[model samples]
Target: MLLVPLVYLVIALAQVQAGAYAAQSTAIDAARQAARQPEGAAARAQALGELHFADHGLESARWTVELSCSGDCARAGSRVTAAVEARVPVPGVPQIWGGAHVPGITVRAEHTDVVSPEES
Candidate 1:
């Protein structure tokens, strides 16, 4: 017989995905702010600091930020990015899922903020 608990497990998995998305979104916001400033050590630091605050609720790990000239990102501006994958165990479907199996959600987002001459 198909277990009904499995249905709940699927729902939980979806929730995890939401969490990942939220975290990445905050990271992007920080990147956008940083991009507005000129590429420099201090500017990057401020941007990253803001991002950390934004990711307070979401899982924050392996934060990444880069500055590029031309292409998708211009040097005057910068790109901010964050990535994380979290594995959440099914709450009520342990038996249905068999051992330590659960759902894994991975998310990544990039933000590009224009760097003003003075900001740089």
Candidate 2:
């Protein structure tokens, strides 16, 4: 009887956890793809696009991406890193309450890849 509400809450929390996992997976994939790209702007745009495609409910505006390259990024053998941070939305929960807004869980991921030395 009393446990029913608790069960529902647990289910809701699990859904939120699933969303967080999805966001994290998307971030990781996006970072890895961006790190493998040669152009900066194109890479960022493509990564964002991919993220949005994979997670439609997740807002692109809430995500931040950082790209770092060791040495010349365009040069072969250079290492590139892409870091992504995103706020995972809780299902059925609004961000605002009582004139104040609550924040969602933050998930972050990073990937590093080396340019092919022989490719360019």
Candidate 3:
């Protein structure tokens, strides 16, 4: 009886932890990639693509990346910021229920990197 709930609790915690790690790493990698790119649109696309490469058990479709720049993205010394957000579903939850009805935890991370002077 109690054991079942405990097992579920552990599974849920593990999922949350993995999702958090994925969000953080994705944010860092995406920011770095964006900082290296000269175009905002290209940078955003690259950052979004990074989600598919994340090792954690994240569903890329459930994630979003938002970007902001200190100035012209291509300018040396400018900083590019990437914010990643994801909704991780609880294990054993059926998705047939709409997302609004499904239980999930929201995880987010943000990272910033400066544009390299040589890239300008």
Candidate 2 regions exceeding 4 Å error are 1-36, 42-56, 95-100, 118-120
Q: What is the TM-score of each candidate against the true structure?
A: 0.43, 0.63, 0.82
- TM-score, ranked from best to worst: 3, 2, 1
* Residues 56-116 of candidate 3: C-alpha lDDT, one tens digit per residue: 7555326777878999898989998888887887888887878676778898889989998
Q: Please give, for residues 1-120, the per-residue lDDT of candidate 1 as tens digits.
A: 457667776776665565556545544555555555434644554455445535543333233434343333335433433232233333444445644444344444544445444442
Worst 10 residues of 3 by lDDT: 45-54
Quote the positional error of residue 34 for candidate 2 in Å: 4.2
Residues 1-120 of candidate 2 have per-residue lDDT tens digits of: 999788878875775565556545655555455445666644664566456535654542255666677888767778777666666555556645731344556766666777665544
Q: Name the regions of candidate 1 deviating beyond 4 angstroms.
A: 1-3, 37-103
Number of the predicted model whose TM-score against the real structure is largest? 3
